[model samples]
Target: MSLSFELTQSIAIIGGGPGGYEAALAAAQLGAEVTLVERAGVGGAAVISDVVPSKSLIATADAAVAIAEATDLGVQFFARGGDGRPLRPQVAINLAAVNKRLLALAHQQSEDMRAALVAAGVRIIDGHGRLEGDHAVVVSTGPGGTDFDRIEADTLVVSVGASPRELPAARPDGERILTWTQLYDMRALPEHLIVVGSGVTGAEFAGAYMNLGAKVTLVSSRERVLPGEDPDAATVLEGVFTRGGMTVLSRSRAEKVERSGDGVTVTLADGRTVEGSHCLLAVGSIPNTRGIGLEEAGVQMTDSGHIRVNRVARTSVPNIYAAGDCTTFVPLASVASMQGRTAVFHALGDEVMPLDRLRITANIFTAPEIATVGWQEKDVTDGVADGIVHKLPLAVNARAKMMGVRDGFVKLIARRGSGTVIGGVIVAPRASELIYPIAIAVDRRLTVDQVSRVFAVYPSLTSSVADAARAMHNVGRVAEA
Candidate 1:
């Protein structure tokens, strides 16, 4: 897509996370004078700590799980000692080595993003930056933040990202009681980990640790895991967690976390206590919009300190914009990147597509991952949308049985009269990858018949998606009739 106008304008961006980096690149490529100010190098927390390292750790956990599951597929290993007796070893995770590798990977990704930005003619500044009114950004640079640099631009974009939310009663001490960011510092896996929160982050870590051969206890304030996700998907995951030896405490609210000798104790609201070698807080995150001069610059903000930006990512102030976790939008890295580019395109007179929350795709990285896009089953049940839902179990799929996969299902939601695919849910291994076609169906507004017509590779997991769509086609027809 080409810009409609010449790049005579100057653009300044703060926070070099996915959103800031993308905005800088898009603006620079459009011939604008672009300057990006970042405090924690390029790629920000998403690369340096959060998404990259965490997902890499999950990949290692997946490998461990695969090794354990290999025996079910006729794969076995045996060792003999001096006495010639057969010995079998258990699957173990070298957590220190895994953490080192993932951290290195994160750092490498950060450097790669930095290099790309530098090569794109975007001025990069390593500093703490804030809005100096609407037209310029002031950055604290040099040793001890003793020096300052200012960049004046016609338009400004803020993508400062966010940090893990810390509860006052359950403060993370970074040792036995820790936040997700500090989890990688452990040299060995905890003997027992108590994860507070049943949200995506908490569930992901709890399942990952369990798969990596660690005892895990997940504390959820709600009755079920993944409170607002698809009910069937949540039930499947809860069963998986229980079968995998994960202790899930539902309807349990953690009141406080205290460091005991060599371990930690979590006190629940019901006067019950859970003791574990380590505790991880996955409650939520707070936008890094505090003391950033957003309010002074006439930018509207939410009660939680999140900047309020329109669909085009433009803030209340016409010349200023915000994206990523800092803005009041979906906080996924992909959404942030799109918001970044959209902000630049709209600001620079390029053709822009306003982001729609309904079309967003989200995936939970847990054992038997859960992925969803567009409308959900709850939406139809709650009368929020006119739709029909159909479900097909993966157990019925030829490939799933061959792969020794016993759980998971494909669910499709379509408009009642038109049969246009509106939403979908996938529960399976690598559901992250499997959900893409469903996302495409949602984005393109493809009818169930059109989706069913798309030939899927035989004896493959994706064929379940086609099957689900085919099942929904009849449902849609009956609804119309």
Candidate 2:
């Protein structure tokens, strides 16, 4: 790839999520005139409603979990007890204040993102944007609005993102029945909360509310929570959820949710009904692809309604690229941000690295957050990949022992003969942070020996990663027995 585009080439990015804003900055840095059109805010759902807000809420819950274990650290919570029963910790969260802070953090992040884009000379348009024809995008304030403008660009990037999917029978009143977005508006935690769907979103909220002192019931249609995650990782997470008092109704599908007097009634596919103070629908997301003039502009879409795009994020229509949740791939903010940058590089005729579907790292914000990168068990088991796996318990790590963390582990996968690190999974406190080195090892094609040689701080949880890598280096010798 060679740089060939003119400096004055105009690049218009529609949508203002992580993908859109990131593409705007990248394009501007390359001296392209960039115009970003957004309806809600510059940071889109990633900041305003979905990612940031949810993570903020999760932080509070994680703190509660940490404090509940303070007694183990010789920190006294109550006077030497009268009852024979041991004192278990408790937390009382003010949902009103918690949500208010979450919204504030979201707004601040949006403003920060907008400021960064503007500072980089990207024009920000506050309105809905749609393709006018082949080379122009029309921006309007909204439906039945007057203020509008048209932007003509040599290249267009669509990062419109996605919205929460809603079922007709289980409509949200933004009160008892809620979507993930409406969760921040809650004035009080649901006394007996029922979470539907056991994907990353569902598992995250279910674990979060349970930590925050809510009696949580997780309704899973699959055999386990986080069905798309690594199987062993999912098992560890399910064990943690169960131990934390969450009711996991695995293989029980929720067919409908309806308001029943002061609470909500969730009817299962088997005709079993579970009543709770509130129900949260995390059945997954629908791409924000409809009514955007995507098809009218000659952008081809898949049968499932996702935009058709190659690894480089290019749509069927020339000069147009799509990224983020709008495209058919794992819908994660990290991937969206990467695709956004890739689109900017490719569209500008600059030397570009195409997105590789395999070398992706994903993190779930559940307690003892699950993070994974690269090839999985099925891939190796099905003969699609040749690799060896080594799993090490976090309980063996000095830091984990000191922290009283008896659960979770770090697993490594490496190519069979070459011993090249191909994948890794971490299920521990702040596993998101611990998985980065493994991700880098997988992406850079580093060998198990190389990973084991990397410096790991003594008495730290991260050392478990290097320990797993070391075990993989000796896996062949161990396997022979």
Candidate 3:
């Protein structure tokens, strides 16, 4: 619904990423004058360097993986050798071509977003933007950044995203030692990649490179990869990593990364060293919220430098709002877009649905993706949520057998008595897509029986979702009886 106000309101946004882009579009649609200031491109890091490009690389890697897995599905390829003996075809990746394609995809997406914002009547300024106060923004524009433009608005939105967290001892040189953003510059795959973190980012790249035919060594500080995610899912991924010939050094922390002769050496805190042609640091990220005049404007900020915002994406100051990684909210591009719209709606006096962090769906894009929404099995076990869990392995599903999918499962959690779906996890090929129906169930508070009643396409992976919901129904009844 379009929000109508007595007077045309002006909204000035800093950082033209997902959050800022969405806010500008939404505000413009609601009859507000919107001005978006971005130092990078329109889609910000999410499109230009991070999500779009990274996912594209993963897609190429997946294609390579699929070709290898195809042989198991009765597919065969052969080539004649010089000795007249048939040779099995091997899959290989053109790193330079893959990087070029993904970068082009990112650039095109940024351009599309820019065109959309312009068509929506949003005024976009390409430069560095900072808040002058709660009601105005100052942007440094021009070739040399010597020009300045001030935009006065009734409300302000800050969506400055975050950057990969860098450590003092392992500074990225954009060559041997690199950050995630610097990955595309490599013309060829590294002979061996040492990933210094076992979180989502680390595990993802490690798996991707390994699948792309590169020797990968994952150095994890935790006992398992994806320590913060569901344990069962992590176990499956770790098992896959080991089976795929990728070395996983668990409970090992990288203390320093030094450039060695024609390679890099990662020194562990335990005095162990691993040498690799390249190193990728995926420790975490820090919000890009500094030097933005946020403190001067009296906005509340966390000790970690993230903006403190309420459910509606509002800052301590009423008219000022923040979203994306800059705010204390789930740092996902989808969540950022939602928060942006919610902020604009709340500011325009329109009815708004405050974001519920629990309902946010997150996915880890490994070979077999791990996706989760709402509460988890740990939440139930930790007594944080009153729920019962039901897990159904994909091995039992007909589709999984036909596709040679040996790993992964669907786990559902529901309220004890009412059987209302509260959370769920899916570890499967493209679990990201399969988890959406479950996310809807969580959002609507649908009971297990209710979900079981919904028909899923037969002989599809989604059938596992319905099957789990149906099984949960029986468990709920048994518990009640």
Candidate 4:
């Protein structure tokens, strides 16, 4: 379809995630008329079901972990049973109440985002939007698929996102078997929870459940929990998982899951079986690209149905674009939001920069959160790049020592000759927050010396970032220590 759209500055965005809403706001600010169509709610599944709810659930579990650690700080507790016997210092958890708070927070965030988009003068449509042709889209606003609304725009941004992947052998029943989305509805802690697929989601839930006093068994098909992350970071996290009383089944695969009278059973491909009170499937996600008329409208898509998009978010169709997990392999909301903004800028003929993923920062929300940015550690290890690595264990950091955190580290990688900060990994509590400066250094092409020269708050966890940067400036000085 050689559709040439005469730049009318009319932008239509499908899906109201960080990607869609951010583009709507950007196009509106650029003096374009913007329409946002979302069927579920604003902020998409990232806020409503997956990101917010899971993080909120983890927060609830984290509080329990903190209290559990307080015994060493001279904090004593007393509890007794009916027979005047000391009852195992009962730290109880109300799963129902925790889930209630999680949903409340997610819904609140969605509504807040919806309000923000409307306030920015972006017209919002509560419906599912799909491509009609080159420059047109059809929206079904009916409750029973009875009515439709047609919209035409000079430019369109697709940010429909993705859904949790469920295997046929272990489908989520929303009760005994749960996906990340349905876990929030669980009313009681599982006596033994089996987490299948030790990716980011599985590891996080396994760690959270352990902190919440549940017996968790993490089933990994890989050698380590987070195989794609920095090797050292993954190793430290696996150690943390092991010491926390969670079983790590390294290089193990689940063939199927079945629910019996009283519990669930996970059968491995090797015919080995493990029984648990509940099970969670965290294999991955499938892009919500089907039935959206993407191909019929001349937009190209991969075999698995993820929309093919460039760094500027442009699809094969001239005036159409895609962002977020629906278009890219990376599933971070921050990256999705940036891709959206880039799409709007490019479509509107404004100054735009193609997304440089090497400068992108991403985080995993585990107990000791793993955060990474810039060029990958593989570049240095493969001898593809000239760089030096500086690593500092958190056990030596004043704040980490004070907080009793002993199992994480901060590592920085910089160009050998120029000392330009290129990549970094941080595995610690609030690593998400700690990765920002390193991200900025990488984004702005700042040298390790330049990053180290910037003063950090005294005795702060963030100061460790600077310490690693300083070591990198001295070319692997900290690595030797």
Candidate 5:
């Protein structure tokens, strides 16, 4: 089906991540000529160096962990030892093959995104796009390089995304001290990986490497791992990581990282040092807001250098908008895409949905993923919400039991008076997929009773969600009685 629009304005989108690409498609589909400027491939850092590649690597690591657990399910392996002793079970990984597969998947995603954009009639300019004026941009090949050309647009969409934050004292060499983006280039697993930071990215890499047969040490400046996540879920993950042979150092800040011959040493702020074969710095990301002429064009930015945009993704300047990690909103691919689409919709005079942070669902892709949507339990505990919390453990679920999942649970928060489901948390395998139902409920403002009435498949992991909803209903009844 072809979409028709009466507007004849052209839009320029800088960056090619989910936000930039999705906005480009939306604008083009709405009959606006779109030009997408990208320094890298079509899918930006999320597809090329970060999300897709990291997740693909995790997929192989997950398979290895599954094989290790197969013995418990009566799957035995026999291996003849070189020393004449029979080895009952052994698990091995070809790091080269795994890296190849990971890169292959990342490339496939990039190609798919390119094809989609091309088919949608969005012109992709291979260069760094910077705003030359309030209504124009110059695409450059490199820093201080020749200006390829300039394009003027009626509207501009800034989705410049972000880069790994590097400390001056702990600069990554991409060998011993590495950034998260550099991990994809490694063909061999580290003997021991020391991951600095306990945020989502740091915890995920630390967990993935540990599962892939590498001893992992996670250093956190906070009191606990995943300090920003739900406290209960964080506690559960911390326990799981410890049981999985991960050394988690809390309240430790990495002040410096330096190469020590073949290995690396990370110094803590408290005069302690940890040595490992490799060090992965996952401190955070810095928004790609510099040298974009944002200040000259009146685009307001936060103190941290993230672009400040309104609910419709509009910058302080009327004709300019921003989205993705470059904005002050949560750095999530899903949220970025929504912000991009919303920007395009508003620019084209279409119906625009205001950004709703409460409806956004986010996941930390650990061994047992932690997915959360809507309000958090801490909000209720802190009297930030007029709600009650209900939790159901996966150990009580039939499917979880069959799948040998002893850890993990689903927790739901509902409004005390209306029983309206406000938020939920799922800590289990494939929690990313399982959180969608809760996301939909939160987005549509569905009640707990409405969620409980839905017929979830019997003996499925999702039954835990339904059970949690049902528990909420029962608790409501007890409160009224």
Candidate 6:
């Protein structure tokens, strides 16, 4: 069925992240005249600075680790030096080349987005778009220059995204003190890297750099690293990081950072200081909600500065909508895209599904990716679930054993009385891909028995998921009197 919207009304989208661009495309496809305004390149942080570049670097690091593991598969190596030390794994990274590839991929993605929008008849404007008044926008072009223009639209979608939060006392100079966004600019590898923040971004970068052959120290203010992630998953990752030579300093909050001659020093809250070749501040992200006329337009904002939006992405102001990292929703590319599409659908007076936080799936791309969907154990403890929990260790899986994976597991949670799968977690290689079936099951409200009946390969990694489901099959039986 062809979906149609009012052809006369014009739609304007601010920001060019997955949320913004995907909404623009959907709006245009729905037959609305759309104009997309972006200050940075089209692909946003995911394609340009943060996700893509970091994963590419991780790919290189993974390759090096793989070569080191080849000896277990009976690959013999010879020493190339006079000292007879097996050539030291001989992997050299050209930072310039890596950066070049990253930019090229980003540009290609941007171009593809632009071409798709142009082909769909969506107008593209390169500028910083800010609301001037109701249904009006002032676009500042050419970064920091006085090129300004005004445009009018019937509906507006705000998805200005986010920036890395900085410490007031330890502002990044973009040199010795750097944010995760600035890491792509470094041409030489740091001899030692001190990462401040134990969140997903911090943990990912810390593991990536450590695998890339840099001495890494992860400083966390929380009791454990990745405090927000699954407890079991976090425990396993902490052990892996420790085994891989990463110094994890829990309960250590970085109070200040200072540069001293070719290196940097991080002072902890307790007055202890650690020196390193570089410091990466992955503290958190601040939504780009300021100077966007949200408050002037009567849109409510949270105490934490995120735009207050409903499930359908509507703000306090009727005509103004918000999505992506600019709102209180979890910051993820997939969720952002869904929010953007939902915003457009609602704005155009079409049938729309409200944002389902429980259905959203997220993955942390560490050595063995951690993927989860639905309820959390902590949430369950807080009365969020009256579900039975089942866990299957990867060490028992035939594929994992053959692949030499000793650490990781699959966990599923189902309602105690109904046996309906409400949550799942996977920690293993390619866990990101393996989580999709579980996500679909959760989204569709499938029972553990229903999921277990589905066929799985005999000796595959996905068998762990099946095992977890089978383990949950007895939940209802045990719950009954």
Estimate candidate 6's alpha-carbon lDDT, on a 0 to 1 scale: 0.88
Give a tens-digit lDDT track for model 6, residues 217-285. 999999999999999999999999999999999999999999989999999999999999999999999
The segments of candidate 4 whose C-alpha lies over 4 angstroms from its true place after superposition are 1-8, 79-88, 476-481
Clashing pairs for predicted structure model 1, backbone only: none
Q: What TM-score would every model get versus the actual structure?
A: 0.99, 0.95, 0.98, 0.95, 0.96, 0.96
Which residue pairs in model 6 clash with each other?
A: none
Model 2 lDDT per residue over 435-477, tens place: 8999899889999899899899998999998888887776655
**Tens digits of lDDT, candidate 5, 307-406:** 9999999999999999899999889999899999999999888888899999999999998999999999989989998788988888999998888887
lDDT of candidate 2 at residue 239, scale 0 to 100: 92
Off by over 4 Å in 3: 82-84
Candidate 5 accuracy as TM-score: 0.96
The residue pairs found clashing in candidate 2 are: none
Candidate 3 similarity to native, TM-score: 0.98
Which residue pairs come into collision in candidate 3? Answer: none
lDDT, candidate 5, equals 0.91
lDDT of 1 by residue, 331-409 (tens): 9999999999999999998989999999999999998999999999999999999999999999999999999998899
- Span of 10 residues, lowest total lDDT, candidate 6: 1-10
> Which scores better on lDDT, 3 or 5?
3
Error of 2 at 33 (Å): 0.9
**1 against 2, candidate with superior TM-score:** 1
